[model samples]
Target: MKVGVVDVGSNTVRLLVASVGSGEVRSLEEGRAHLGLGEEILLHGRIRRRKLDELDAVVTEFARIARKHRVRELETVVTAPGRQGGESERLLEVLRRATDGPVRVVSAENEGRLAYTGAVARTSVGPGVVAVCDVGGGSTEIVVGTALLGPAWVRSVDIGSLRLTASLLHGNPPTRTEVESARASIREAFSGIAPPAPELALATGGSARAIARIVGGAYDAE
Candidate 1:
């Protein structure tokens, strides 16, 4: 079936159209609008009415794009914003009106699972243990498993780049002290859990891609 999926993330609203069949999904088209909902959430502890209206408009346009592509089904999924923001029902109502299809907030576990499967599906990773990390705007999801067995462990850390920046890094080019404070916050967020070692570790997210452009697409302890 040809399906259109709308991802409502804290940093942006994205649309992905694809053909799903025979255990594969082929991308047809993609689009996104950066709304920076995380910053609002950090400031107000909830999504304001104005932002909700903006979200509705974006989703409506995305739905139109999906129809233009002749998709059989269009579904919307909310990520960190839905989990962290207050008055989630108001958000859901707005999305349901805009897309006129399925709309729901994705659970943290499922978010990790989808991130793992989506990343691993596009890579040439072997059937050994693999780990995938998605650093979203309001949270980060980590999944560990093999491509064959699927995710065995999933965890979501409730701190991401946007939140950290809005909460700690006030300067445009954050000062050294601010950078260190952000690093310390990140460390504290992940201090509780230890993930199993994997044969390969994959990072896939907006921040990851942006950093890859500057750091040559690879990461290591520096």
Candidate 2:
């Protein structure tokens, strides 16, 4: 069967059209739109009308692409923005109208588990304690588990690239003071959570992918 999955995240809206059957999945099409909903929410405590309108257009386009691919089923999942106090109902209504499908607002725990599963499935990690880190616009989820058993421990921190950038990095180039401040804030946020030592660490999500491209090589825990 062909499935279309849409992720309405804090920083971007992403679409994936894939063929799934017999425990195999093949990507048919993918698309992304940077809506920066997290920035808007952080600034105004809710997604503004303008950003919502933009998200509607992007989701519509994704639906069109899915239809073009003749997908049999469509699913939309929303993250941080949905968890945050915001105009999520209005935003979800717009997404539902665009995709003509059920739109689910998943919790942080679900997000962490999903991300961990996806990452471990794609990597070459063997049975052992494998840590998966999914850094999004509004939160960072760290999950530790054995490859054979799945996630045993999951922690979600309310600090991410976009959130940190909005809160501390005001300058265009981000002065040294601003950088230190952001680092300190992130350190404080991670101080309480302790993840088990892992045989391998896998990074997932937009920010990690971007870093991989810049680094120009396979991702390594080192």
Candidate 3:
């Protein structure tokens, strides 16, 4: 089987396609375009025409690629800022017009689970309880439990880098006030629900990787 992963995010629209279990098909067909989808919606409380135009163009290009590959089945999923009801409806319509295969809008909860699964799969599995954190463009999924993530204990926070950056930080490198304020915001949201602090574990997103990259010494070598 052939599979594709599409993340119609607030800041970017991304797609990756690969043939299942085929070592020969090592490189997945991938594409990316910045729509800055969150710039207005999550940042300014509404969507703007210019951004939608930019998004339309990106989805069109991705759809064209999927059709060209003659993919048996294509799965496109959206997250975070894309979860807004009416907002999602409008963006999804554009995606349908762009792709040849099936495109489904995944819920925020499910998106979190997928992320948790993806994170866990990359690590040593089934030893004991493992916590997974998925910090995204508009949401953060923190899965704290013993037997993988199930509903009850899994919680998601609607504060992500884009939201924090847009709302709190305005300077190029971020002001000290913004840093402390956002940290305070995180601590506030994390109140009461004391998740097991993440172990020295895999930090999966760019925000994490960037920190690693910036820290440089031990992390950058790998």
Candidate 4:
């Protein structure tokens, strides 16, 4: 069966179409739009009418693309853009108009679980606990679990690179003070949180990819 999923996120709206059978899934098509909903939320506390209209258009296009690809079922899910913003009804209504389907704002725990599942599915990991970290535009999710048992621990930290950059890093290349301030904020956000140690750790999302590119192959205490 071919299924489509549209993700309404803080920084980007994405669509993924896949064929699933025999306990395996194969990607057919993927699409993304950098809508920067998080920046709008930070600026105005909610998605404004103009941006909502743009979102509606984007979702409508994505739905059309899915149908063109012969997707049988399509689901739309919203992340921090819907959860952290105000006037959710407005957002939902716009999305429903586009996809003509129910749009759900998934909880943080559900988000973490999904990230964990997707990350571990593509990697080779042992039976021991694995951790998946997803850094979105408005939040960061940490999920720890084994591949067999699924997520055992899930945490959502309400600070991401977009929020951090918008709030603190002002310069193109942030000044020393701004960098320190960003570090301080990150430490504070992660303070008092202790997750179970994992034998393997995987990261997902745009910010993580950008960091990986800058740092080379893998990240560590080095």
Q: CA lDDT of each candidate?
A: 0.92, 0.90, 0.68, 0.92
Q: Which candidate is the best by TM-score?
A: 4
TM-score of 4: 0.96
RMSD of each: 1.3, 1.5, 3.7, 1.1
Model 1 lDDT, full chain set = 0.92
User: lDDT by residue for model 1 over 1-222, one digit each (tens)?
Assistant: 899999999899999999999998899999999999988888998889999899989999999999999999999999988889888888899999999999989998999999998899899999899999999999999999999999999999999989998999998899999999999999999997899998889998999999889988766656
Please identify model 4 stretches exceeding 4 Å from their true place: none
Task: List where candidate 1 sits over 4 angstroms from the true fold.
Answer: 219-222
lDDT of 4 at 23: 94
Q: What is the Cα-based lDDT of residue 201 in candidate 1? A: 91
Which residue ranges in model 3 land beyond 4 Å of their true spot? Answer: 22-26, 145-152, 196-200, 216-222
What residue pairs are clashing in model 2?
A: none
TM-score of 1: 0.96
In angstroms, the error of model 3 at 196 is: 4.5
- Model 4: per-residue lDDT, tens digit, 136-179? 99999999999999999999999998899999999989999999
